[model samples]
Target: MQVAVINRSHHPLPAYQTEHAAGLDVRANLDAAVTLAPLERALIPTGLYLEIPPGYEAQVRPRSGLAYKHGIGIVNSPGTIDADYRGEVKVLLVNLSNEPFVVQDGERIAQLVFARHETVQWQQVAELSETGRGAGGYGSTGTR
Candidate 1:
């Protein structure tokens, strides 16, 4: 599961904080601090270019600590980086709190999770089989 990457920022490459961590922390590659007013969003660059393998994708996600502490999150949660994409990784960050938040250079702003995906082929069919909970969706089951 090796990926080809080019890092132009002064920050080190993204890495998992824990041994069993699923995602690697990605940093912001800014020369100076950028302030985000409440309810504002910005496109922050990572200065990382990756070459993901076919059938795989890089998922950019928000950090739980930042979300809980500062109400900072990704505008498009789990933003997908397609395998064919070869551009610098950028994160769409949003401030959900009522106060401003500052993003510093080389700050851990997001996480990247590499996952394998499948391509689907549509099959024309007349009818489909029935199940116990047929077509149940969107809170069909109780939270409990």
Candidate 2:
């Protein structure tokens, strides 16, 4: 699906590294580097504005390589960009390691994944249909 976007950064538009990648890698748009102390979080800009279509959302996700190598992660894990939102995309990154992590300009800091979503209509039901393990939550179903 084609999407409408405006890029104001020096870096190229977000792109999929592989032929079958689910997300497009986004870069950090900054004049200088940002250093994040351990356990610290910062909002980094991408200089990207998007017009996400209705019935869809753009999710900001962390790169597995960054998380595994530098302990960098998105503060919201999957930050949601609603269809109606029209603003610059920024990533909230947190340093989960013991040392500081530097966020360089044009660095691939996060990923943007576009996905379709459903709008929910409230039924206001008195009860939901019951089933086996009707009230089970979380680990109720044994992990196999």
TM-scores of all models? 0.95, 0.96
At residue 140, candidate 1 shows an lDDT of 83
What lDDT tens digits, residue by residue, belong to model 2 across residues 70-141? 999999989999988898999999999999999999999999999999999988978899898888889988
Give the top-scoring candidate (TM-score).
2
Q: Which residue pairs clash in candidate 1? A: none
Model 1 stretches with alpha carbons more than 4 Å out? none
Clash pairs of candidate 2? none
Q: For model 2, what is the alpha-carbon lDDT of residue 144?
A: 45
> Candidate 1, residues 32-141: lDDT per residue as tens digits?
89999999999999999999999999999999999999999999999999999998999999999999999999999999999999999999999999996778878886
| Runs of candidate 2 exceeding 4 Å displacement | none
